[model samples]
Target: MSAKFHWVLMVVFVCGCHAGAASIAESFTSYKLVPNIVTKAPANVISVKFPSGAVVDLGNELSKPQVALTPSVSWNAGDGLYTVIMFDPDAPSPSNPFISSFLHWLVINVQKDGIASGDTIAEYLHPYPPPFGDIHRYVFLVYQQRERLPVKDFIAYSTIGRFKFSPQDFADNFNLGDPVAGNFFRTQFNSLKTDKLF
Candidate 1:
């Protein structure tokens, strides 16, 4: 190949990699998760793939995930105990979020191998944005646990229900520190069907 053509290809390849990383950071900032939900962008990107083969991109809109096993999450983080939580910061409605940061799922002490092996404090609750409300951002955050969370704390959090649940608070209470990886997707009510195979 010509030297000029090779240079062009290299530029494209480099830019593509940068864009992939930037998209994850940009999406978190553009969605205002930086200061509201998390203090800083996670260092790693998380992949959440549902049972029907739908993957959660930065902020892509997806149909309601049907009742099924917790989506499989793949990441490059090293082996260690992890905690995964999913919540909707735009609960009720983005404009009027009387109940903000509604927790959808919480699994603690998850092994590096898989989330299913972890202790499920609270079962996964699928996205259920209000029919007339605007799109909701369902965010999943993964934290590297320093140590096993207290069993008592798990019982307390589980009893609090899903509304007004704060993942940050949970982290702080347990001293999990900031999340190391995260992912989010937007969704709204759709009665047509769920578990889309795309």
Candidate 2:
């Protein structure tokens, strides 16, 4: 083979490798679960562990798993209070989401690398996508807070049926700025009973 031809092949091989890696990373960044309201990328990635010791990935597809309690989360936020949000942006159905971004969980004033405690504003609501509905994206977003803010009213606001909630608006209103870390998982109704909840 000619030296010039070999060089071209090597270049193509390297570019292909890079493209594969980029596509994997883009999967998380391009996730439509996170409303265009908040920044797409975060400063860091947070690790979330289910009760069954399963660590959640960016777009892990889970069946109706038994997520009775809140998943444990850890992040490197240094010495600052942080806010955690878990919501399903594809409520009811993705095509016509009248109740978009249904808030599932909210914890505030969390310390670095810690699980939510008494500071939980809204309680965790396990994912329960309706049968035959589109897969729902359960997003977990973390934000560094400026200070401890009153969230009781905000928690109440989430309970109202068909209430509109925007993570971007919440961050802006509380001056939380961009998210520090985030991750999500996808779930849908399990008619076959193939997967077990953690």
Candidate 3:
């Protein structure tokens, strides 16, 4: 077995906590997207071209492929923290109010500075891994941390049991055309203050 699995089992055993070990809240339906790894998101404008390189064809539902962010961005104060978000506009559920979004992958304090090719988000899937399931929309976000986080688990601030971490709070600064939240709405980040020192 991979060392990663052993490490996970050990953590579970040590704490005596049998958490789900995966994102059980929701899933993505559009496409298979992983965080940090660069991918192309097609333009939303009808006249604009799509990433898969096609125009929006409403007739053939499956023909119109989905597009996502390109994995990183370049901004001044904030750029190291990255998150993955998925949402389905047609899902019948509580979070989906016709615009509900499900958080698929959340990676905090990624080594934005020295990240080279061939690096996957797998290194920091401590509390959970990416969730897979029905028609879900996803967004991978990168935030600029005022300070570098020394967390091994991406969800370090996320609540597993009694205590909880409000992820919304961190990304709140960049919400709704807000400079910070809007910075990473659907873009990649580079040139963060914290240069990776590994």
Best by lDDT: 1
User: Which tens-of-lDDT digit does each residue in 1-198 have in candidate 1?
Assistant: 899999999999999878876877888999989888888777668889998688888888877754244688877667778998888899899888888888888888888838887888777877767778788898989999998776566765565667788777877878889888888988887666544531
Residue-level error in angstroms, candidate 2, position 51:
0.4
The CA-based lDDT of model 2 is what?
Answer: 0.73
Off by over 4 Å in 3: 1-64, 68-100, 111-141, 155-198
Question: Which is the winner by TM-score between candidate 2 and candidate 3?
Answer: 2
Better of 1 and 2 by lDDT: 1
User: Candidate 2's residue-wise lDDT over 1-198, tens digit each?
Assistant: 999999999999999867754543465558754346465556466788888666777888865664545788887678878888888878777777778878888888887767645387677887888876688887788898888777664667447722466777777888988887877788887766544532
lDDT string for model 3 (39-120, tens) is: 2221111121235453322111222122331233222233344332222222233233232332333444444332232123
Q: For candidate 2, report its TM-score.
A: 0.78
Candidate whose TM-score is highest: 1
User: In terms of TM-score, how similar is model 3 to the real structure?
Assistant: 0.30
- Superposing all C-alpha atoms, what RMSD in Å does each candidate have to the true structure? 4.1, 6.7, 21.6
Error of 1 at 13 (Å): 9.8
